[model samples]
Target: MLVIELRLMQIIGLGTALMMPIIGNLSDQYGRKALLTLPMTLSIIPLAILACNRTTNYFYAYFAFKTLTDMVCQGSINCLALAYLADNISYRQRASAFGILAGVTSAAYVCGTLAARFLSTGLAFQVATFVSLFAVVYMRIFLEESIPADQGEGITQPILKEGEEDNIIQNDDNAPTKVPPFKKIPSLGYYLKARFHFNKNQFADLMLIGGIVATISQLFIMPLLVSPIGDGRLLSIGLFASCVYAILYSIAWSAWVPYAAAAVSTVMVFAPPSLRSIASRQAGPREQGKAQGCISGILSLANVMAPLIFSPLTSLFLSEGAPFHFPGFSIICIAITLMIAFIQSLMIGRAPSTSNAENSTEV
Candidate 1:
């Protein structure tokens, strides 16, 4: 049962990796409400099926439906919500908001797991269906549309465009910027091509840095140092810890070595939210959705690639073939990746801090 569940999750993760950016981009155009509503409404069907039936056919049906819907639902809500916050909040406050949001999610996860201990399987799923339905209804009735149809072009603008110059073009009747042709449904090939146009090695290295940083800081230390060090510096600390964790894990001689190395990894939990906060601050008013989507896409890509990159090497070295008996060989490669990320994090830390005055004056 555990192995089946793990495989199911892995499949779902792959789906999420492919669909997240596309769905996020769609939400930017059609408004978050509609896109958000469709997924929530569809989610109930699979849960309700599981609640009522235990037959093999029903289980397979549930799995199929869930795999499809989970692709749409998993990260879409968070991406849209972060974009919504970007629309409303000042950049200075975004880091705290992101942190609080992450905290709320962690609390919800803990509560749900604890609650599951008390409820039967059917009851748990039924309760989830009901909660999902309630959330959909509440959002439909109460959540005002954050992105309107007319301003959709704003979202499609190049994220790295000069802020002041873009604003000038927006204000002037004579100097209109050329609008790229809008595709209501972007092709999978187009998305893959556009999303991954960067140097693969560099991208992989940077993601490893961010991933390790986020894993260690957010999971272990961010809760403690978030207020004191600030998000960017906390990210730097997390990256440094990740570098250390990688090195230790690589050279580890005993099983206990990996366990000890993990102790130093508690600082990475802050990386994700902190990075989101910084990216949100960088985007223009209407560009938040795009920026956040890009971030999510990068994360998903990393999730898809990490196992492929690490598993083979680990397997080869651990097998009975006659090579140097280094169990830590795979870990050394990981450590090197972490080092690249650490250097990037340091550069980010040393970059000029944006004053509230500058943010306010930005377009």
Candidate 2:
């Protein structure tokens, strides 16, 4: 059962890794509003299908549709939204903005998880279908495009800046050819094929290492002392907390140890968004979308590796005839990975700080 679920997760990750860059890049080329709305609209189909049927065939179909929609929706929305935020806000406010965004998402996740625990599966899916439809409708009717257009373009029209502000405009006859989307797929296919294999220990490593990427989208802590603390130091503190979390989970002797670890892990939420806020300052105005897309791509790659790594490890350790008496061996492996992340955070602290003038210009 664990293997089956892991296989499903593997497929979802593959889809995400393959499709995230395309959707994110397209959001940069086209507009955020459109790219964000389209995939969400598509998600309704799978939800509706799941709500209506519970047969084995329908279950498989739901998985297929869910994977496809997740590919389109997963990292794309967050990437584009960050790009949009970067475009509109000043550098000084970016950390707070990102923190608020992460906070809201974390709150929503908590609420949704609690709701899921109580709701029946079929009824939950039915409610989700309506919720998705509502999201699509709300986005279409209420969400406004933030991209700015030049003089002579309509106020509501999205700006399409090819290069930097005044590089060169080309005629149709002389313009450079665009690469077809198909050209990109072979590389993604190769990545998936090459990375599909993993051992139990490797799976455990992936799952532990993946916390970095997963936390980026929803990690948050209070921003009261951020200015005084600096992003680098704050990130290092969070990473240390995460290391503690990994250690606690690894040595957990009882079920309540997991819950206690969860309580402590809340401190780890500060790391990713601080990293993002710092990185956002490093990128130029025109390249925010591309940069965020690359980050999302890395996150997708992490997602791809996680299921392949963790599932087998989990199954092995939980089985009756395990190598040693340690039931939490997989988690100890994850702790080692977390220590690596903690070291990376310390390195981030060693890097030189950017000047205020440079930061002001970048925004």
Q: Indicate which candidate wins on TM-score.
A: 2
List TM-scores for all candidates, in order.
0.68, 0.74
Clashes of each: 14, 2
For model 1 the TM-score comes to 0.68
lDDT of residue 132 for candidate 1:
79
lDDT of 2 by residue, 1-363 (tens): 645655665676677777766776676667778778877788788889989998899988988888778767775766777777767776556666766566555544444544455789888888888888998889889988755322211111011222322221121110000011000111221222223434544433332323322333333344564555555555667677776766665565654454355554456666666666666656556556666777777766776575467546655665678787665566567667767877886664334434432223221
Q: For model 1, what is the error of residue 346's alpha carbon versus the real structure, in angstroms, after optimal superposition? A: 1.4
- Regions of model 2 farther than 4 Å from truth: 148-221, 314-323, 349-363
lDDT of each: 0.58, 0.57
Candidate 1 Cα lDDT to native: 0.58
Q: Which candidate leads in lDDT?
A: 1
Kindly list the per-residue Cα lDDT of model 1 for residues 155-246, writing each as its tens digit: 22222233444342243211000000000011211222232343544333333333343334344455455445555665566567666766
Backbone clashes in model 2, listed as residue pairs? 203-309, 203-310
lDDT, residue 315, model 2? 54
